[model samples]
Every structure is written in C-alpha cells, then in structure tokens.
Target: MHACARVGLDFLDSAPYRIVSTVDLAITPAQLFEVLADENSWPRWATVITKVTWTSPPPRGVGTTRTVTMRGGIAGNEEFLAWDPFERMAFRFNEVSTSSMAAFAEDYRVVPTSRGCHLTWTMALQPANLAGRIGLSLGAPVMNRLFQRFLHNLRRYTDERFSAQ
Candidate 1:
C-alpha cells in the first residue's frame, strides 16, 4: 500500500470532505479510460488542466510523477497511487511547494452502463493550515461548480473525439 493510505487520516478528521463530479458519456468505459489515463491529452480535453509534464519517466502507471498546471497558473505535482485500466485510478498531490492543501487525493472511475458509461471524479482535500481551512470552507461552492465544468468538458471531448472516428 502507498504511504498516502496510511497517513493523514487523523489530520483530516476535523475536515473530512469529498467533492464528486460525475457524468454519463455515450462511450465505452474502455474508450473513456484511455483518454483519462493518457496524461498528455489532459490540456486538450480538460481546460482546467492547462499544462502537464512528466517529472519522471513514463509508461505512466502506479508511482508515475507529473507536474500539472491548473487554469490560473496554479502548478502542482501529482503521484499516481493506483492505476486500474478501464475501471478506476487514483492519485495524490505529492510535491507542489506552492499548494495550500497539505493532502489531496483524486480518484477517477469509469463504470459501464447499458448505454455507455458513467464517469465519476472524486477529490479529497485538507488545507495545510488554519487560514487555508477557512478559505476552503468559504470557496467550496465555487470549487464544486468548477469541478462540474471539468466533468462536462471531459464528456464533450470524449464525445467529439469518438464521433469523428
């Protein structure tokens, strides 16, 4: 098991929280998973993820590290904790010196449905300090709205890509 699973449970007890964004796409779970698992394609599909670069070498699976720049120039480093093709994947913010969150975990899952597939993105975050905690509490709604947009963007991108084929 990754160290992340063992740490932060007690630290986050006061602020245990999770934000989830989900979408149903008219595409196979495998197809959607491919797009998500390909880190380089993030900027093309998810506008919020403005840029991505592997800090370490690839065949991107568990333990791969990458730096991601978000919409407003917020850069963070991520480490893949779990990778399960066509089913689910999970990652954590690992080494972003500027990030205010002490611990952040994101898990993405793609589940097959009768028509297509349901994709869910879930994030767990704990601020680094007391002030950071207050800020997150206040801005949670805005953050949630943005996450929804990210999910919708994924759906739009996947649909357009597959339609053109």
Candidate 2:
C-alpha cells in the first residue's frame, strides 16, 4: 500500500483526490533525526504504526533498507535515499512483498531548519489497473489524515522525550 499507517476513514464522501501534507515541529534536528533513524521505534510515536520489523540496525544510514509495517496491516520496504545525520534523512521503496498482501513504494524525508526541523513522508502510486483507480482516488484524504496524525504523534513523542531530559 502507498500509505504506511491508516488514519481518518470518512472516505464515503470524496471520490477522486490526492493526499499531500507538510508539518513542522519545534525540536532539534538531532532529536528528530534520532527518531527517524530507528524504524523499529516508529510504532512508539505513531499511534497507527503498530509494528515495524527492522531488517537493519539502529541509526540506519545511507544504503540501508528495512521493512515497515503499520497498525492498519499496511507493510512496505523502505530504502534510505539520503542519510545526512542531524541535517537530513530520506528513503524510497519500490515494493514490499509479503506472503499475502499488496506491495508499493513510499518515500520519506526529514529536513532540518533553523529552529527545529521539517518531516515529510510521501507516496506516489499508480493503480495497477482501472479497477484500482477508485482506491487511489479515495485514499487521498484518508492518507492526508494519517499524515496529520503522524505529525501530532511525533510532536508528542518529542515533547515527552525532551521533557524527561
């Protein structure tokens, strides 16, 4: 699936649409980078991310590849695209195969700013056939909601961690 975690499900309304979201948080790039580096720990921050079985080690860097599973039963392989620690983090995936499930690619990016950082996770999917078109179209708003939730959860996670230190 293009979307990792699932979000709001009020999709009986919209027909054809695309999901695009951008969120900024007030936290050190170092802190944000640490969170992004650990794929297994994703579920801890994203409420919808119930699972993340890592095929790599902590602080994943350039050329690293790992599988990402979400609470909504969505799973995909993520490959590191850019791994500039404390400054940027990005990844791409062409597919995520499973014993019984569909596979797709997802691109993730984290860019540092003067105050804190900006994290963007995006997916581009072209339906296999006209039959799948309805899904991609209806998925836009739902995915956008999931993206918003991710940002909300990320902010909470950062706040809790930084507060404890």
Question: For residues 54-143, what per-residue lDDT tens digits would candidate 2 score against the true structure?
Answer: 577765776677777665466667666567777655554435443322223344456778867787655444444555677656666777
Residue-by-residue lDDT tens digits, candidate 1, 73-153 = 677777777778888877787655554667777888789999899988888877777887898889889989988988787
Instruction: Return the number of clashes found in candidate 1.
Output: 0
Off by over 4 Å in 1: 1-15
The candidate that achieves the highest TM-score relative to the unseen native structure? 1
TM-score per candidate: 0.84, 0.71
lDDT of 1: 0.75
> What is residue 19's positional error in candidate 1, in angstroms?
0.6
**What lDDT does the true structure give each of the candidates?**
0.75, 0.60
lDDT of 2 at 136: 59
Q: State the TM-score for model 2.
A: 0.71
Q: Per model, state how many residue pairs clash.
A: 0, 0
